[model samples]
Target: MKRFVGLISGGKDSFYTIELLKQKEYNLVALVYIKSTDIDSYMYQTVGHEMIPFYRQVLDVPIYIIETNRKAINTDKEYVHTLNDEVEVIYDHLYELQKKAVFECVSVGAIKSYYQYNRIKSVCDRLNLSVLTPLFNLDQRVIYDAIIECMDVVIVKVACTNLGKEIVGKNLNVISGMRVDNWCGEGGEYETAVLDAPFFKKKLRIKNYEVLHHPEEEDKERTVFFMKINEIEVLEK
Candidate 1:
């Protein structure tokens, strides 16, 4: 089995990709989280990363934490530079992980973001690390339903005016009744965290949280609301 380090964002696609890798008998050595302090990070998931600790507990894999330094950019050159910066931290941690044993590849949840796929492939090429995107090119509805059947996820952030603030902090199932503009949730429409999944020994029980409204962005036609995680409990299966 090939050894790998998965990039986790506490989101459905990332977790679902990891689950698929696990089924394929990959040696998941560690999880890498490229934490972004910016709520509006372009290269990575910014919200719901606070649940990473819970994710580690569920997966029983060591986590390598890295901070993202790139600011959001629009130009192709600046965007490429920023992506390289993001990959640098992940690559640095992969190097550290390799001291314990040889790691063959890095895993991600890239589906349709050509920009993300290209940037990741570019860095992995330089690092001699194989880039695995299990969810690549899969149908959006398939991806959405696959996640629903595999885990218990929660909406931690709703970035679209189409989705109300009430949707945040609710389970992924809550989307069932809504008219989803994007079932994939890949376009920054919303952000989620896997509270429980098939591989998890226990599920996360979210007790309390504070909803923060990002009205400025809403006025600007962007992410409207986010949740601040305050309390969590682990429920044994």
Candidate 2:
């Protein structure tokens, strides 16, 4: 049996990657996630502390949450520096997992960003692990639709400035049309959580959320609404 490890961030791309892998019937070894040590180094989809538990329960798989302080060395380099640091941190963790000697493939939820995808690919090459991207080069809208149609998704955080207070706790279907285009939440307008996807045996029911807004820098000029998760429940059907 071929074994694979998935790098999940609990976002659209990562979640979609997992879905595609399940379709291929690869033996999933573990879900690897990086817990941000501080907000300063939190560049990639590293949201708040909610990710650790959320993914564990949702994936229903063994999770390796590594704590790393890796950050971008250059303000000018953007994703290159930051993504390279992340790949290093992930490779180190995977090396530790390799002691068990089960996983030979590392699947990622990368799309469009060759800088991000190629770094992981290079590391996988060095580690002698096959790197697979289930969502590579696909249209962003198709990815979003797949998540909504096939999974129970919710917006846990809206990172963009234009979403305002209207988005927190709202379902994807409710926040469609003018809101998505104007704000571009799918294009980094916000971040989301897969409360329940098709892969799950049960769906997650959430309650007691409050919408709050924050103003971005003068140049961005948009306000983002943070959805504070007060209570969550997993429902059985």
Candidate 3:
């Protein structure tokens, strides 16, 4: 079995990728997370990131949380190694982790975003680590259904006009009836957080939270809904 490091964004896709990796018989050695300071990062998920550390307790793996200023210096389809780009920061962190841990592959959950997949692939290439994207080209609807069926996920953010703050903090099933282009939020229509999953030793419980609405500056008609979780707790299953 190949030892691999999984990337988690506190979202369903990334965490679910770990489940797929397990199914493939990969030895998950560690977890890496990029905590973006900017919520609107072009390359990473930023919502519900505050609760990421709790995943260590649920999965029983060492997690490395790296902070990025969220500066997407390189936006081209093909990535080039650069010092100032956020991707370089990821490469640097992984490079440091390699010295302490032995992992040959980096697992990602990029379903449709080539920009994300490409950048991560570029970094892994430089580190001599293979990239494992289990959900790279799978059907979004099927993935969405599987996640809803096997995981306890909540809508933590919404940016589309069709969605509102009412959906925040609610289970993912709430949006199943609604019409949306990307069922798995591939196009950034919304964001989710996984509270419980089949492989988790413990589940997360949101103890308290408040809804926040931020209207888009470019388009005043559109508002982004966010669930600001003030408190969260981990419970035995």
Separately for all candidates shown, the number of backbone clashes (residues 3 or more apart, or on different chains) is 1, 3, 0
Each model's lDDT comes to 0.79, 0.67, 0.88
Which 10-residue span in candidate 2 carries the lowest summed lDDT?
Answer: 73-82
Task: Give a tens-digit lDDT track for model 2, residues 1-237.
Answer: 678988877665676787788888888878887776554343356553464565566556798877777774434423332454645787677888899758879888777666567767766876889998877787777777777788766676766545555766667665666446522253566777767777776666666776655434446554656665677766774
Whole-model lDDT for model 2 versus the true structure?
A: 0.67
- Candidate number with greatest lDDT: 3
User: If both were scored by lDDT, which would come out higher, candidate 2 or candidate 3?
Assistant: 3
How do the residues 1-237 of candidate 3 rate in per-residue lDDT, one tens digit apiece? 999998888899988998988988999988888988877888777888878888878987898889878588878898888778878878988899999999999998999999999999999988999999989999999999999989999999998888887899999999989998999999888998999988889999999998877644445654788888899999999
**Residue 187 accuracy (lDDT) in model 3:** 84
Instruction: Report clash pairs, candidate 3.
Output: none
Q: Please give the RMSD of candidate 1 to the true structure.
A: 2.5
lDDT of 1 by residue, 1-237 (tens): 898888888788888898899899998888888888777666778777678877667667788778867654543532343444554565566666778757788888888887777767766776789999988988988889888987888998887767888999998889877888678787778889888888887888888889987756645655488888888888887
* Cα misplacement distance, residue 30 of candidate 3 (Å): 0.9
Report the error of model 2 at residue 143, Å: 1.8
The all-Cα superposition gives candidate 3 an RMSD in Å to the true structure of 1.5
TM-score for all models, in order of appearance: 0.90, 0.82, 0.96
